[model samples]
Target: MTDHPRSGAHDRLVTSLGTSIVTGELPPDSDVDPVALESQFGVSRTAVREALRVLSAKGLVGARPRRGTFVAPREQWALLDPDVLRWRFADRVDGVFLDELGEVRLTVEPTAARLAASRRTDRDLADLEDALAAMRSAGEKDADEQVTADLAFHDALLRAAHNELLLQMSVVIEVGLRLRDQFVHGALTTESADKHAEVLLAVRKQRPKAAETAMRALIEKSIADVEIAKKAI
Candidate 1:
């Protein structure tokens, strides 16, 4: 119970302030006064400092030589950190980003699906099925959870292709998922889910063109959704 309170205090301070920091409430070059944060979060300086240390480890902040702590540049941010990803989603989610994601998906994911069709191992298929099942179950869940499952499926399929070059695109895919986390749930029709299932079927059947076609349908739908969202906004 004592540890739980301490843990909860630390997490609340970090989660609230981390979003503010990364979303530019505390912009780059902005000083982070530990006392101010402690006051604002109604916690001790020790707790606030510990929260800042977590951010510092992730390269979101840096301590200057006797000056103070300041926010780090976007390039220094921990892209893979779950907090950073959420902050990014909260910070800037524009149609241009989604459009770029759709373009990349059209160019990359379909072909990866085709290659997986030809090269996937039994283990790969088993992993793919697991991810698909997870995704299906997550469809009833939040967009964030669904995107995590959806990404696992595509990432596994890419790895299944056995192409080192394709594997490098994992970061790009992760970034795309982060960008699409909201737009996907908002725009995805039930038909979109079925379309993805068709792509999986094509991959399972070892039909390259079919795999490509089905994947293109999925990306094309995403592109349309991006365009529609742009017009609405």
Candidate 2:
């Protein structure tokens, strides 16, 4: 598939605008004048319009027939969008945001684990095992590797559930996992590895109840760690 001719300009504008809104530089409800943006970014009006269209889709901005485009309210922002999530995490880790994200994981991940326990194939199990092995080898000392492996483990679990809708959530889950690990240092290490082991064993044994419980415990611990880190920050 060929890339859009203006995709580069569109993406740059999106990132610039998204970061501004997320960082409060473009305050909520403030007008986002396309003409002004075009001049500032040195992009054409077409590129600016395309960028605003993308941002609107992501819930970062809103447009109306009479009123011009403007930054959306925080409640209206698509927190699940990976780009939006990353922008939020870029400046600081908001405790309320972390709690909201935790609530989402608490609602989704345990159920996914339960489903995976019943639906996972041999290949799925192998993927989970590979991620776990990577995690173990990376250990606490290698934070970046640990985060990547940890994300891989969760991604494998979500796919193992064999649900398209749940699988679609991989990006949001990935963003949350990455931000948590990156900002909340010392949260995922031997302790998290052990918890993941419980989940892996449960899935391996095809114990849906155990898998659900293990995942719940793991997420709960992560939420606690996030809270602790929030206090520290």
Candidate 3:
């Protein structure tokens, strides 16, 4: 239990460092020392080392032969690591990662919407409803709560579609959530939440074509929003 809060703080530091890397705040190929990093973050040396270890595991940072810890080049980032993904997404909302993630979402989510339209069971609809309700809770929810609700909304829709390939696409959702973790605000916007409602409405109404269209629109809008977010940098 004693380690719980400490563990969380360590994770946050790792995440913040990851954010710094992906956003170019910590430039590629730069050298880092634990003592310097510890002082910079105002954490203990052990915490700093542990956070660096976490980054190393995610392939964002590496220990050189004797040059000390160096920030990996941009190409070395483990794009699939959840931590990496969120950092990338949150790093600079206007980046190529947002555009790329949006493009992928367009390809994957509409199809998932179509499947859920045809195969979604009643319980699946209920789950979707629950997610929608959570989203409407007015005021910024916690980051984890946002991730959970965002993911739950997507997962419930995927389940409703019931295609084995669609079900297999859960990995994609996982990737998206990782991208979301870098946000200073709640993971998604009210606009995105509104679009999510449209998707849910189409699915609940059993309009497969409508659901597919709505899902597509949502993806397009999210892409636009991400572009806007990137401009803030």
Candidate 4:
């Protein structure tokens, strides 16, 4: 994303500040020291300000008259923002957050699968099949590819549901999914592929109830994988 010196500085400042804030090093309502940031990061004042503005837009920081800029309360943060999610999971998986993400997936994915069964088109089926095939072909050495394909499969399933709001919700879900995959990718087995296959098959067969059940099982398996991976870590 950073292609130039100035942008790189801005990004570095943002990433540093954001990580600090997310990790509670700069706890809520703490002052954001632009001068210190500029000196510490060797970034220009413009770069520092620009980074602050970006964080502000993401609800990570806010300014008040006579008070300068400060980190916002957690409730004010855009938790679903990709940057925030990345920061949260960048160093290590937050078990609580990961469990919360799993809960969301459990609640939404099964219903999404049911709708997909009734709404999916031939193209949707093809896309799901492609993603499934990618998953199956991804061996232990192909962790990155496995993650991408796994994400693609869920994305295809969401699209198959034909709901605009659900599609938008995937924006948030995708971030957590990627992080979880990074941790659990090594734990994937033929059974994992088989579970996804079950969902795909149900969608392909247009069996709403079966699709729902399969998706629930798939997500449950994913949650179990994360639990296992967390212990391994």
**Each model's TM-score?**
0.71, 0.91, 0.62, 0.91
Model 3 lDDT, residue 180, Cα = 44
Model 4 CA deviation exceeding 4 Å by range = 1-6, 230-233
Weakest 10 consecutive residues, lDDT, candidate 4? 1-10
Q: Give the per-residue lDDT of model 3 (tens digit) for 1-233.
A: 12323576687788888888877788989877788777777888778887887788777898867788999987777776656666765524334555666777888899889878887888998999898777676436566666677788888887887777767667666665555445224547677788899998888888899999999998777666566656665
Q: How accurate locally, in lDDT, is each candidate?
A: 0.76, 0.88, 0.75, 0.86
Question: Local error of candidate 1 at 15, Å?
Answer: 1.4
lDDT of candidate model 4 versus the reference: 0.86
- Model 4 per-residue lDDT tens digits across residues 1-233: 43333587788888989999998889999998889988999988888888988888889999999999899999999988878888877787667877998999988889999999999999999999999999889955688888788889989999999998888768667887777766775755678889999999999999999999999998888898899888877
Superposed model 2: Cα runs more than 4 Å off: 1-7
Clashes of each: 0, 0, 8, 0
**Total backbone clashes of model 2?**
0
Q: Candidate 3: give the clashing pairs.
A: 85-179, 86-178, 86-179, 93-230, 94-230, 115-161, 116-161, 120-160
Q: Write the per-residue lDDT of candidate 1 for residues 91-128, one digit (tens) a residue.
A: 57856657766777788888888898898888888888
lDDT of 1 at 8: 81
Q: Model 2, residue 20: displacement in angstroms?
A: 1.3
